[model samples]
Target: MKTTGTVPRLTARGVATRARIVEAAADLVFERGVAETGLDAVLAASGTSKSQLYHYFADKDDLVLAVIERQTERVLAEQEPQLHELDSIAGLHRWRDALVGLQRHGGCVGGCPIGSLVAELAGSDRPRELLRAGFARWESFLVAGLTTMRDRDELRPDADPRDLATAVMTALQGGLLLTATTRSTRPLELGLDMAIAHVEAHRLSRSVQPRGRREGPVDAGPARPAGTSTASRSG
Candidate 1:
């Protein structure tokens, strides 16, 4: 809940107004995208005037940043606990299924907000920096989970927790992007399957066991074979 830099203080009405604007903006961006959605559209959607919009954000860039922050907070809030619960392969499968279900049910309409922003601001330093910071926070959360798995002996001691965490995130983002472009959930589903398989294969085991088909069961017996130990670089 804590953020760096100077925090803005506002009256109750002002807070409500800002919240409404942000909510509207998030929805609009998801539905139409950042490039297609404009300030007037956001104002109209939020039922606010130009002056009111300006009161909250200095400009479109400022509003975009606020929306990005809101999205980052939402994603972390939803996934943090789930990521922390991945002390076993079963928990990891459940998380993967839940993620896939989200995309499937939504028809892969909108890609990841952070990923979308990264693509949108590919050439701009400021937005790219913000996007990187957001991704870093998410990756850090995943790394914490991976570290716990290592401590629990669920993962191999030789596994680079940070690198694997980044790989998982990168794969998820790539899958989401592919799904969005193709308007099909197959890519996302397959990508998650591969990611989970990669993790399961590399786990500290002795025999090569195939990944499980069920969504919420840890089938990695004691004799499972360990996969390769190389760390995958992030994109």
Candidate 2:
């Protein structure tokens, strides 16, 4: 989160080295809370020296920002191709299922890596902003999907995509926190299920014929906000 004038240019090898260090830092921080993971631990885990770390990062906090960025990318990565295509109810369901699968795969131990980081660093302005930015990126995808549903008349004209997107994100976050606390994915599952069901009312009847049989790609409705599908817009 510390800023130093213009960004420094790095060669291919330097970029790789910095990436290796960031990856190590992200792993350590995810496994153990950020406070517990120190420069020494990062160095040991990353197999890098003090000079090498300092060359790329200003300090522990600076490195942590990098780790945050890394973890954010990982979170988005897990939701990939589905995350990119979340413009309909069916897409939302797919995204929800994929998220639940991630928790189940981990036995629900980590409790939303980015969410936990936000809770721990809430007091720090830079960390908090970065965290918020990451969540915003995630939220934007929902907004897009929901907006399309509305545009396609798949959702009620009165429904608000932005608001619904925020609600869905809140549900997922709350559920993840509870899941982490309870060590069960049920809370998260239920939360997502309810959130998805909330959208059922807004969906066009034709899309839900016979109940639960609806399965298809979300129609590409209306023009999208430029770059909504890209990483830049996400941040």
Residue pairs clashing in model 2 are 87-145
Q: Residues 1-235, candidate 1, lDDT per residue (tens digit)?
A: 4322344777899889988998899889877888899889998999999998888777888788788888887777766557676655666666776666666667677878778777677678766777788899988866776787777676788888888877888788998898788877666666766666667765766422244323322343423221122121222
Provide the TM-score for each candidate, comma-separated: 0.82, 0.84
Best by lDDT: 2
Question: Tens digits of per-residue lDDT for model 2 on 85-174?
Answer: 677666776787778777767877888879989868978998898899989998998888888777777787888988888888889999
Cα lDDT for residue 191, candidate 1: 70
Candidate RMSDs in order: 7.3, 9.0
Model 1 whole-model lDDT (C-alpha atoms): 0.72
Q: Please list the residue runs of candidate 2 whose C-alpha ends up more than 4 Å from where it truly belongs after superposition.
A: 1-7, 204-235
